[model samples]
Target: MEQHYQLLRKHIEEICVLTDEEWDVVAQRFTYKSLKKHQFLIQKDQLVPCEYWIIKGLTKAYAIDSNGKEHILQFAMEQYWTSDFNAFQNKVPATIIIDCIEDSEFFCLKWEDREYLCHEIPKLNHFFRIKSHYGYIALQQRILSLLTETAEERYNNLIKKMPKLIQRVPKKLLAAYLGVTRETLSRF
Candidate 1:
């Protein structure tokens, strides 16, 4: 539990330093959770009560279309955050589902607690703002890639940017993420 908190501190410190007092305040607001492989973290049409910071293992955020095809949106691992951002922010039902790819542990922060922490600590607010900016930029880049790049190009770019992801995520999930069939992905 202490180690998980330390990991959270390190993740935040990458953006901005936190004083001990502030850290204590920030730490207490989070609750620990663990889930086994294949467990649902956020199910579609359900409420998203908190955003989770991964302490260990991997998870995938995806949506199932009316035809029952899974569309992978994101893969989150240790030190990464995962949530149904649209629902979490709007206080509505989730449009996507998040599930554990492996047994996972996380520190969960409810929306109200997050808001309180941001208001109480200016540096924490700055850290979150920077993190959100990066997330937005990444999302934009992903959209542009899907719109303009071929599957092969996207695969090459993903390998170049996040080789570890290729190694960690299953090929089928990678295929879905790249908007390609498994057979097509196999050719790359």
Candidate 2:
């Protein structure tokens, strides 16, 4: 957990500069946790109590379709945030699952704690607002891609955005993300 602190501090400072004293205040609110490969951080239909920031490793947020097929909504790597946003925001049951893809370590920031911190540190409000804006833009692009892009095009776009990521994920998971069979992803 001590080792994870530096990474978390760095990520936050990149978005909003913080003095050491301010950082100490910022860090104190987070709870450190670790998860093994395939372990779930948040499961469908459960209440999401916190949002996680990855210190190391990978996770995927996904939903199981009516046919029991998994559809990957997002893959979060080091320095990324993972959570069922609707559940977290509304205090409702989760509609998706967030699970580790590898042995992972991260920090969890509870909703009430986040709200408190943001109010205490006004800069944090700006920081989160910027992050939320980007999240919206990315979601829009994803929706557009799903609506109109071919699987190969989606693969190419992912490659452009996250070249290192494609190699790390299993082919089957990549296929799920692309909304295609493994064979189709391999062809791409």
CA RMSD for every model?
0.9, 1.0
Stretches off by above 4 angstroms in model 1 are none
Q: On residues 5-61, what C-alpha lDDT tens digit does candidate 1 reach at each position?
A: 998999999998988998999999999999999999999899999999999999999
Poorest lDDT segment (10 consecutive residues) of candidate 2 = 1-10
C-alpha lDDT score of every prediction, in listed order: 0.92, 0.91
Instruction: Provide TM-scores for the models.
Output: 0.97, 0.96
How well does candidate 2 score on lDDT at residue 63?
94
lDDT for predicted candidate 2 compared with the true structure: 0.91
Q: List the residue pairs that clash in candidate 1.
A: none
Candidate achieving the largest lDDT: 1
Worst 10 residues of 1 by lDDT: 122-131
